[model samples]
Target chain A: MKLLSTCSLRKVRGRNLLIVPDPCSGNPDRILEVTDSFAWLVGHFKEDVFTVKTLAIALSERYGLDDDTAAKEAANVIQIWQDYHLIEP
Target chain B: MAGLSPDRALTLLFPLLRLSLWGTPLPDAVKQETRLLNESDWEVLISVAKNQSVTGLLFQAVDSLPEDIEIPDKTLVQLAVMADRIEASYRRISTASEIVLTELRNEGLNPVVMKGLSCASWYPRPELRQSGDIDIYLPKLPTKSGRHFQTSPDGSLHFQQDGVDIDIHSRYFDIHHHTEYLPSVPSPEAEWMMISLHILKHATTSGVGLRQICDAALLWKILPDNSKASLPIIFKATHTMRWHLLLFSFLEDYFHIQNPLRHISSKPLLSIIAHGGNFGHHSTSRSRLLKAPSFIRKADTAFRFLLRIPFSLRFAPREILPTIKELTTGNLQHAFTADSHSILH
Candidate 1:
């Protein structure tokens, strides 16, 4: 999954947020709070797409965690981001 | 008065900002004071930075302090977050500016971008500078009449475009009605003169802010030696040589730039900036004057004008009467006049 072209990650008022511009003029821009780890994960995929397996591998390398543990964590974070419509498959 | 005898925040913030904007070596006294800042002091410093529209610059300074310097992790995080948000906003404004500029060019108008984006280009990371409305100078457009004829007397036409405000100016400088001293449009000489006069205009009226002064300082630092030598003569032609010296000297002291200009009385101007924050939004009487009854508002405005008289007289005496005339006549004529005929959206 990759971040939507129109969406971006920004830290708003001290909170990490996934900013998605609203399509409707009457609606406000969507701001979804993201965890620090999730923001770090997003940084790695800024120029490319990533799947749970790739994220897990990257996370394992960065944090020196076992592959199984990293994969579960990556899948959980990615699921939340997908639900928020920040990620496009 | 408040800025003259600055409180704790200004004391620490001044040196930190100098370190941030230029790589000026921090004084021992300043470093010690910074180390002693409590959490509350940090909050005040952050507030001042935000109010002055220099959060990203302050963040860089704070982040680059020596290893032994003990800024709380939470403070660092706050500054970082705010800086990120400012940069994000700058990106939006930059894209919007490009769209507006392209559309103006498509319409056969030669729009020379002034202030906002132009100043940002001098910074190491242009995206980190605080962005505002785009000010474009259209030399071809006549001040008296144009496609956008609803412009203010000062030759500015404002409209919303590409989700950002665009101010089209038919004239380069707002200091004087006459352009006898100014050279041809689109030249570097005229641009620098315009920037200096813009700062003087604000300083003599509502009040100048640190951001504009920082812009002038950064722009001055990059100018060639010959260009620097030529500026005094241009300012002299416009009868603003005194103001030019005062401003550059102040910048030299504040930003600690190399080759200091001859010292002058910059305290008054510094006080104005410290009190005004960004565009006088943080002036002591601003909120009170805004929410007061009509009579009280008038009184407050008069009082503020009186306070500004001495500074105006010292810096740019030619502007005092014009400012007074503006105050009395009121400038309610030019608000978002090009809405129906916006150049772009």
Candidate 2:
């Protein structure tokens, strides 16, 4: 399957959140967000997951964060989104 | 030249060089040209030489280029190694695409090989472009399981080929809006029509910056459009028309986007949609409704969740009127902008 895009969480309401597709995502319209931290991205989005280390490296370049910080933040947000039923896992 | 940074020049030229070496059988002159490199180019050449694969060498050379060019020799050696590896990888991919096409044909499936493979084959000079993997578009119905035919229990489809991967799709997107509008048209029997739809759909949804899409569109325009023309015969060859309709419908709702038919000639897309072809459904994480099997599953959910918000917001931009206007009317030249370097294989 073609990968449409990727996104990240941004807080919206007090506890509610909004998910935003990364502008850099190749296909920006493939998935929809349920909340800031979660979305209904794709059926096989799980298959494309990168490790925290890998994600950190990728995010660091775009977000201006260091690798360790990027990894930790990504891991925390991912875990929270998963628990919230926003993502597939 | 005045505006281009050394890093940017390296970034663009490196891929050109790698693709040229890989897809084209370079003469000794070109090989020598590669060997005699400038300080920046030398870094890339050395990186390719050290790395075993040309693709890997290209990536390494790109990665090792100094943000500021203080250390030249070390970088040049690194680049040479990478260049060598990239050259090898390109050859492997070209060979692999032919093999995969043959295998698919042997299985009685007519695969309209997409992306890099098609580009390499159809382009005037294949060596000028680099491709990561072979993307083959096959017209098939998803099983009742609602997944690609080859997806394993782990959700990864492992093809036997090395340094090459496959992404098979029953539909172009998870959300496609126009399935219901064209339920009466018959399924396409000809290879050219099917391939044309594939290329058209890709171009409409992704916009134009992608070289692969342009290649597909160009090739499709040149290919003959006539073949068999019978519903029963087409159905027998492929799956039922209902499956296609459902797949298209599902894509419409899932992505929350309109049909790509708007961008292309309406006749063919209308025909495809008129047939019982539907889009795929919005991909909700099964893990969300059940226990996920792995960390990848969880990560997938998280990523999707993040994506859904913007997708929804974009679908209903009026709700966020100011941001919508700013984005839509802003100076941004492209509808979608991505860090292409990050996705390089």
Candidate 3:
């Protein structure tokens, strides 16, 4: 899956905000304050098409975490992002 | 804040606006002024900022204030809320712009983004520049998706995609004349003329606020020397030299930007803005007149528009006759009918 082309990540006043366009008719964009880990994952999605398994492996290698721990964290984050319409298949 | 004299309030308000300018370092003088302002003064500034449609920029300035500045907690919350809403609007407008532009491009049209989004890139925080709608300039009406758009009385197209407002203009200016010099393809010169004309158009009619002034100032600051050099000729050709010179002085007066061209003192514009607020919506005189009995209100509004004619003439002498003609005819459409290649003697 990849990050939605319409969405953008911005650093405003030291906050990492993921700007998600609302799928509904209302106008205001949904700005979610995202953690550094979530932002990092979003960055990867923006640059490369990746599945949860691939992303978790990359996360595990980068942070030197166990495979199971990285996999669970990545899966949870991806699931939440998907539900928010921030990521697309 | 609401009841403060507009002139007295502007004394404090101008410094805050200068402080809010993107990429300009917070001046020591501004810091001291901000530091010294009591709660009441800050409240007045907030009220003025809201009226002027510049609360987002004000929030940025306040946010950048040094820790010891002692902003009231209530003021802080208010600005924060305003900033958040500004950000949300910015994102929504940006997305709508992209979608519309893509759609236009897909249909083989070269659409130029105008005003709001065009000016945003020059800001430190693009989103902090509040945008109400996305404006796109098309050479002609779109043929395919044309049905999706609604035609405005002034001949622009309006569309709402995903709940975001978008306005498409067939021509850059609503006013007639001076457009022949503008290139078909966008250039710095074209953008400058477009911005200058937009400011003049609004300033002549409803009175422009600080936001439009800031847009012109910011664009002028970064405009290349070659582009800047072309302005005198463009101004002369467009018969807008007086308006352009006055704008330069106005920027220097308020924004503290030096005029690359010769300076002329700003006259009447500031007072008009102070009294009228953004697009004259917050005009004290207007509000009072509005509250009068229905018949009286109509008379006062007409009288008010008439009173502004002299001020508009002083700034844009070329526009006076056309404007008067339109007013006399009582047909607003006549004001927009293009005068084909007519040059003022």
Candidate 4:
């Protein structure tokens, strides 16, 4: 799935910080600083919906990582975003 | 966005709000008078405005721009998606102010609504004005709220409940000494005068921002005929007419909002306005000066502090106490908190 429109990544203090739109206030609900690893994952697969298979393919081409490892990392990041309501189906 | 950081681009917003709210087409002044910015500036601008508590006004300003202006699609989407939320927050806070005031009145805690809530209605779009806190003056604390409060050095008690900061004041704006200023029945004249005094008081010492100047300007512009008749006398009585007139000049020059007190010159007070909002948060030159090494800026600040003695003595003698206290106390934010970083952290 893709990041929701509300999910805007801001670069603050040289760090990629996630700005999740607060549904109630229509402003930034939470500003969650991203891990360098997750930030890298986001850079490759942004805006458009992407599945584990898609993420694995991009990672294999770019980083030469095995499909299984890439898919595993992708799943972990996706789960974290889902918990935060930052991504869309 | 090209040469400037987002912090610099945020300066573009207040000017944008002024132009957009005019209901006029994007004027030629956009390129020359205000910062010439494009879509690349939007993300940082949005971030900065939010930090400054001006997201509502920023959105309304950009939304009102003419369709022909070439704002990037992504920037537009980012700004537009939050429109409903901004309105919701504004309404929520506005409602909260009404609720708190009504509840306080019921408890016989009759307090005058200070700068934020009272001056909001005077704006072209009241909800767009950033509502920071609901400040009210109560001679005594109300036990009904039951929430614990942190008292600032100025002797004001702040209670945070339901996302609104409710500040209860004892004696300020020198209102206790002049009960006749705001009668039991508050009027626009009284409220605006209080706001002007508040702005002038801060403007003289620490310096104020465009948002505050906007409050005083609009309040003056919108006063009813009867209120206008009585306001000058009140301003004079409060020793704020000179500073108010100076503020009038600043507004007239920057926002094109004319004050009837036009004949009054603000030459003496111009340097204070030069300090810019919240003492030059939006000032390009000040920002550049700040980017200097810490030692240089500290020395510069020290020099400015020394200069303020003579300056305040001439322009605003009321600053003597606060300045002396701040110097002695080392610019502490909380009266009770000893940890210097507590407020920041």
Give the chain B TM-score for each candidate.
0.83, 0.39, 0.83, 0.71
> Which regions in candidate 3 have their CA more than 4 angstroms from the true location?
A1-89, B1-5, B22-30, B280-305, B324-345
Judge candidate 2 at residue B309 and give its lDDT.
Answer: 42
Output per-candidate TM-scores for chain A, rounded to 2 decimals: 0.79, 0.42, 0.83, 0.81
Q: Can you write out model 1's per-residue Cα lDDT over B1-345, one digit (the tens) per residue? A: 122123567656668777777777689988787777766677878887777777778887886677667877567656766666667668877888888787778777778999878899988667778876678888675333223323443546665554566677766786754468776676777778878888887676556667777788888888877877777777778788788878877877777665335777777777877785655443333224334454554455567667778877887788788777765554333232332233323
Give Cα distance to truth, residue B340, candidate 4, Å.
Answer: 18
Ranking by DockQ: 1, 3, 4, 2
In terms of TM-score, the best-performing candidate is 1
Q: Which residue pairs overlap in candidate 4's backbone?
A: A26-B85, B208-B278, B209-B277
| Residue lDDT tens for model 2, A35-65 | 4222322232434755556556655765689
Write model 2 residue lDDT over B91-166, tens digit each, in one string: 7777877876776676677666544565555544354334556666666622222122234231223243554655
> How well does candidate 2 score on lDDT at residue B340?
14
The ten-residue window of minimal lDDT in model 2 chain B covers B274-283
* lDDT of the candidates, in the order given: 0.70, 0.38, 0.72, 0.61
C-alpha displacement of B164 in model 2, angstroms?
A: 3.0
In candidate 2, stretches whose alpha carbon ends up further than 4 angstroms from where it belongs are A1-89, B1-80, B122-124, B141-158, B172-175, B180-293, B297-301, B304-308, B315-345
Ten contiguous residues minimizing lDDT sum, candidate 3 chain B = B336-345
Model 3 Cα lDDT, one tens digit per residue, B123-231: 7778898777778898797767643554443467666767676777887764466768664458888888888888776676666788888888889889999988877
Looking at candidate 1 chain B, the ten consecutive residues that score lowest on lDDT are B331-340
Q: How close to the true structure is residue B304 of candidate 3, measured as C-alpha lDDT? A: 57
